[model samples]
Target: MRGFTVIWLGQLVSMLGTGMTNFALSFYIFEQTGQASALTIAIFCFVAPSIILSPLAGALVDRWNRKVVIIMTDLAAGIVTLVWLTIVLTNGNLEMWQIYLGNIITGAFNAMQFPAFSAAVSLMIPKEQFARAAGMLDFAGAASNILAPAFAGALLGTFGLVPIMLVDVITFLFAILAVLVVHMPQPAAEMIPEGNKRPSLREDSLFGFKYIRERPSLLGLQFVFTALNFISAFGAIIATPMILARTGNSAASLATVQSIAAFGGVAGGLIMSTWGGPKRKVQGVLLGMSAENLLGPIVIGLAKAVPGWAAGSFMSQLFIPIINGSNQAIWQSKVPPAIQGRVFATRRMIAQISFPVAVLIAGPLADKVFEPAMSSDGWAAAIFGPIVGTGAGAGMSLMILLSGIVGVVIGLVGYSIPALRDVEDIMPDFDALTAPIVNNEPAIQSQGE
Candidate 1:
């Protein structure tokens, strides 16, 4: 727990820096070009490499020293930051391609970092504490989401990009130092599942999918989350535009509503950390997500005012941490420590595959399909318009409403799957298999702080 705590604190600092830098860069690009497509390209570069390369990265994490992986990734990321800073300092300008390339490099580093850090977590923390640990991890993300924009906005206005980049570099140094000092327990020889044999890198890279396929419970959970991710992405893709259009493009109102909503995620993490989720973790995840999916779209779709949208958004965001924390705890408790890197990576890759697709289509869907349909003279305007109302962003609202219905159906279907719902009962806990070396204190000395 102590080692995990140290790493968590370090990662949170790094995340805050990363978040601020990302916000500042995105703002810079948008301000310079005034092109929405530029922002899209930047985001694509940020996420695409990680998704495409996660399988290989996961295989490496499982094979390599976990602490080394964490340290090296941070080092690589820091180096990229240094290069960016150098370009700014020397060249006095940065091309879009260079920024895109840097984002790709950082994304690749993150692909490896996530699996390594998550696998390391299961080793350092007790099985019963996985939920609380997951809460703390999520709190990092929620806190960054809330704090980074505020912090970056102020710093970018006062000190400019140079100071923000320097701060990011410092944060990376802090993260690397923490990893260097802490000892991460490695998987023991005996911890490998019985009869499992080492294979080539290619075969091992695909092993996560194969391993999940062998277990109905694991497979079912994966499918459920894949659906959840796909559904959630649609709403996320249009959340800002929806608010802006509905609120008559008042940027302050949009920011206020979003910030208020984001606090829900932080609040949810705090609650989960205290409660440690429900006895039936899967049930808790499904029910919480179901409420989030069903209620949010309805309120937002029918919202005639910003307050309505804000309240709905707040409730929707609130359930995210609960779902994520409960889901992570289940995976941590069920999967073998040795193979967790591969398994968790595969889980992330599949769940996130929908996001890029969603982002790509969201604008077109709203502009060509939904928006016109809900136009004053369009066919859908007569039907759904009377209900959700008509005009700008109404089609997006309709999409949200439809997406919510689909999400609810998916949750109900997941709940009905006995294998998934009863996963804890059917799958044996991996703690028994990995108990011997789960906590290796020799690898990490307690630095009397």
Candidate 2:
């Protein structure tokens, strides 16, 4: 736990620095290009590589030293930031292509960083503390979300992007130093028998999907998240536009709603960290999701003012940490530490694949279908106009409301499935199966073992 705490603190600092840089870069691109598409493309460059490379990266994480993976990836990302800083200083300007390329490179490194860090945590902390550790991680994210933009906005207006990139690079160095000081445990199973051949990369990469497929409970859990991410995407993409359109493009209103909502996540993370979530982890995942949808999107969809939007946003963000922490704990407990990198990476890939798809379609659904239908004299006006009102953001609000309804139904349906509901009872904990030695030391037996 001490080792993990040190690493966690370092990573938290790194996240803050990285978040600031991201904020600065986003503003830079938008300011320079004056095109939303430019910003969107930059984001796509950053996110797409990670998703595409996750499986291979996870396989590599399992095969290599996890600590080394973390250090190297952080170092590489830092180098990328350093290069960006150098370029900015030398040329006094950055091209869009350069930014996109940097994002792609950093995103690729992140593919390895996340799985390595996640797998390392499972080894460093006691099994029972997984949820708490996850909560702490979420807390770091929430804190970064709240602080980064504010800091970046101030710095960008004064010192500019160079200072932000320098800070990011320094944070990476600090993170690497933290790892250097810690004694990271390695699973004995990762060490192959003397004469056995190592598995092929293809086999290793595919292993996670195969492992999840063989476990009905794990597969069911993945399905639930996939559906949830898809539904959640609708609100995520449209929330800003809906708020702005309804408020006549009031940035102040949007900021107020977002800042308050981010606070909810911070509060939720704190509570989860202290409480360590529910005894029934599945309920923590399912019921939390249900509550999140009911309280968040549904309320936001029905609301007509900033207060209502803020309230809905806050409630929605509040449950995110609980749901994520519980789900992560379940995966950590169920999967063997040796294979967790691949399994967890695959889990992430599966769970997140829906969001981009939904993002792409959500706009058209709002512009072409829902908004038109809900227009003052549009076809849906007769039916839904009275409830959601007619005009600009109304159709998007209806889409959000529908997404929430479906999200709630998905959570409820997940609980009704015996495999998913009784997942904890049905699947034995990995520690109970075999007492694997760590760091080449003697195996420490679990109580069940």
The ten-residue window of minimal lDDT in model 1 covers: 440-449
**Could you give candidate 1's per-residue lDDT for residues 79-135 as a string of tens digits?**
998899899888876789999999899888889988998999888878899899888
| Model 1 misplacement above 4 A | 25-41, 81-99, 156-162, 190-197, 244-251, 304-306, 372-379, 386-392, 433-449
Clashing pairs in 1: none
Please give each candidate's TM-score: 0.86, 0.86
Can you write out model 2's per-residue Cα lDDT over 179-231, one digit (the tens) per residue? 99999998755644334455689988987898888889989999899999989
Candidate 2 residue spans exceeding 4 A from truth? 25-40, 86-97, 156-162, 191-196, 241-252, 363-395, 434-449
In model 2, the worst 10-residue window by lDDT is 440-449
